[model samples]
Target: MQRPATTPLSDTAQATGITVTNLTKTFNTDSGLVTAVDNVSLHVPEGSFFTIVGPSGCGKTTILRMLAGLETPTSGTINVSTGSDKPVTNSMVFQGDSLFPWMNVWDNAAYGLKMRNAAKATIREQVGHYLNKTGLTKFAKAYPHQLSGGMRQRVSIARAFANDPDVFYMDEPFSALDEQNKTILQEELLRTWEESRKTVVFITHSVDEAVILGDEVMIMTARPGRVKKVIEVPFERPRSVLELRRQPEYGEIVYDIWASLKDEVVGAAL
Candidate 1:
């Protein structure tokens, strides 16, 4: 199968990461002006998994939407460049299941390719590959309504992976699953990421999940969020989420995140 090349990675993109500078977003609700994100800056290394952890309603998702070009930043810049004119393809996996109810799993996974006018052979090959990776091959004929929450989420992941986006924006993609299902999906995600080395920006409330998946974890403040700090995950790659929990460094890092997170959690409540 021919590798689809929507956006060729230039020398700059391969070396540089995503840069968000002084990014801010505001919304006017019936209650008046509300600032969701304030001066949130991030530098996510290219091909690295970056996770953002913060309290609920802390504008974590807002930041991701902005990066994905779904939301406009009120005052700031997002430079996802390699200092070149080359383009890059990106896709988003939302918090809730974003499957097409009218389409079966196979079609939903292949939808992006179809939109791109990719060859049928390419769509079949790519969709088949990701479905098998996510353990959805057996249920390829199943509709989203016929599947469980975890199964639907798997279809979503498969869809995103099949699209072969250069940059992936994920907002709590695994938050809906049970422990067993979440663990399985996490491992599957890591394996796929290791193979493709695509840049990923994942948003999760679980500090454990953030640490387990991220090469660097960005902690955000309470409401009108800003960057609290970015902590590098010291563990080597090919990480086992189950085993990493037992490691001393993993424990310390998880503790450190909570130590910073607790105050924000409390402050948000007040």
Candidate 2:
């Protein structure tokens, strides 16, 4: 929250989970080659909830895309291994509803497991469980278009969790929902996450969301992005967002992040 400090908050844990070193990305545009991220480095421990918050176009999504193997880094290295044989990120939920409109809730939720050729019984069990967890089991037969925006996002979460990937990468998954729906989904996600304790890297613009859901929150600089600082969350698990927000420390943490973000956000806007 002070000047953009280079000294990251200390966590001496050895890096056995996701490790990134000097990660940079650029794109050759009509104007010229543009660097979007610059020499960013960090490490995420396994089974930890790591959240990232940054100004828009600060390469947040670009960084995530590289981690998910959807894009290649221009330079440097990104090593992410969850030991789940299926894939590194069979578990990503985007800000928008990424569900297939043609598929019903059950099929959509079961899609990943089915693609992995999981047994019918296993698919039924996993998909049914996630759907129920997201409060969508009764609407299992409904297509995406037949459901409300929140319901569709529920299906996306259900599908992502049902896949049972070792790591989850969520990019502002509840950004589009109303406050009530977003709150409900946050609770649902925490409940499911507690059950498995899987690793998750979530990207969000909301400081509250980042603090509430993450074990550690990384703040990124403006365009040509870089890691600014890392702060650890002190709250324990099985957290209720509502309850967590009531504490004085929660308000202070949120204020600190937002206070730190003002300058970067201003730069990004220009």
Candidate 3:
């Protein structure tokens, strides 16, 4: 049984975390009605990183949007109690650059707080803190147009983190970067997650990325997505990406995920 919202959650309940029960979503296109998601459910523990990997058009992003409350589910419940007195706050980082082209990095990073009517001093402090953490302090004055793709994404990450959301929904935020840049950002993200310990639900098609960052990796099927499997990642925290793949179990885990994913990947392509 669940406790009332006002009641404090037990340590076990707090660790039980974000729950998505029987979630479904559908869309109307010119072709016909489409069911993007189908009765999907998940429980992502608080302060743990959860990753979902699937074939293209498999509704991974749709599931993420539903969790973020950006899309209305056809039918389902998403319970995201933070187990804290403060209301749950959620933030999302998109696949492509989402920064305002006209705003400087600092202004863009401060936008969330400004919208919430946070005091100027509070906005200044939080923005400064995240920008420094993301290694963007030097570029704070630059506009989106002036920075490279990877740099622009850093600003978006800073903005999301500075908002200090209780849960983060990331839709392949590092997918656009080159291998070098992606590796760097992935390392930095691990550092941030280690320090902040915020709950994250991340969607990616990259098996390697999913395994490296997720506490648990969920594999979804082709369109009308459903969970194929959920594999617990046992690698200890403060992980080194450079050394991650070298671990003996790393290849085994990645291979298993891919084996489960192969048919769906081919099906999506057809």
Candidate 4:
């Protein structure tokens, strides 16, 4: 994740990911300086999917928010590799509904492209491709209110991919879904990602999810969050999420991560 300083996307167009050094965030609460993240340094390689798992309030969302430019770090530097000069345009999908209520499926999916003033033809190609990939082609004119929870998330996924950002920040995007829908969406996400291989930083509470989707899983300590460990998931993709879960090794990895995370979770509650 940290070979060199970030060059312009023009220089390294396909390169994506982040190099965070001593990243810290503190909130000036009435109680005092509440440090959320503390001197956390880690690398997320371009084209790799890295997932972070930590106890509640362990700064998982804070890190994602920082990467998405929604929050400012108290200290340290985050170098995000944009595939282009448009770093401001990087895509993010959140745990809740982030879609525009007024926009139909097609429009919502194409919203990013439209905002960037992409050519109509290019918009059509990208939106159509992603919508179809997400099984939303039949619902092109459907509004957010017309969709189910899973369907709405699919639209969010479609929109994120249609935008084709250099890096993607996803914070528990499927966390609200039932197991069945979550499973389906995870598979869909993997299929699309298999094709694009875009850099993604995902945060989840589920150990299984972190292992299933991430090439490397980062375990974070409780508040004043720091990297506890970065464990490699050696399973090769394009993966079958359910089938992969059935693997003996899969159970072992999930159990191992849980073993490490359980301690932090306890500490957080204390």
Superposing every Cα of model 1 onto the true structure, what RMSD results?
Answer: 4.5
- Residues forming the 10-long window of minimal summed lDDT in candidate 1: 1-10
Better of 1 and 3 by lDDT: 3
Q: Rate the local accuracy (lDDT) of all candidates.
A: 0.88, 0.86, 0.89, 0.89
- Residue-wise lDDT of candidate 3 within 9-79, one digit each (tens)? 65454444688888888899999989999889889988899999999988999988877778888887777
Give the TM-scores of the predictions, in the order they appear. Answer: 0.93, 0.92, 0.94, 0.92
TM-score of 4: 0.92
Q: Which of the two candidates, 1 or 2, achieves a greater TM-score against the reference?
A: 1
Q: In lDDT terms, how accurate is model 2?
A: 0.86
Model 1 alpha-carbon drift over 4 Å, by segment: 1-15, 82-84
Q: After best superposition, candidate 3 residue 254: deviation in angstroms?
A: 0.4
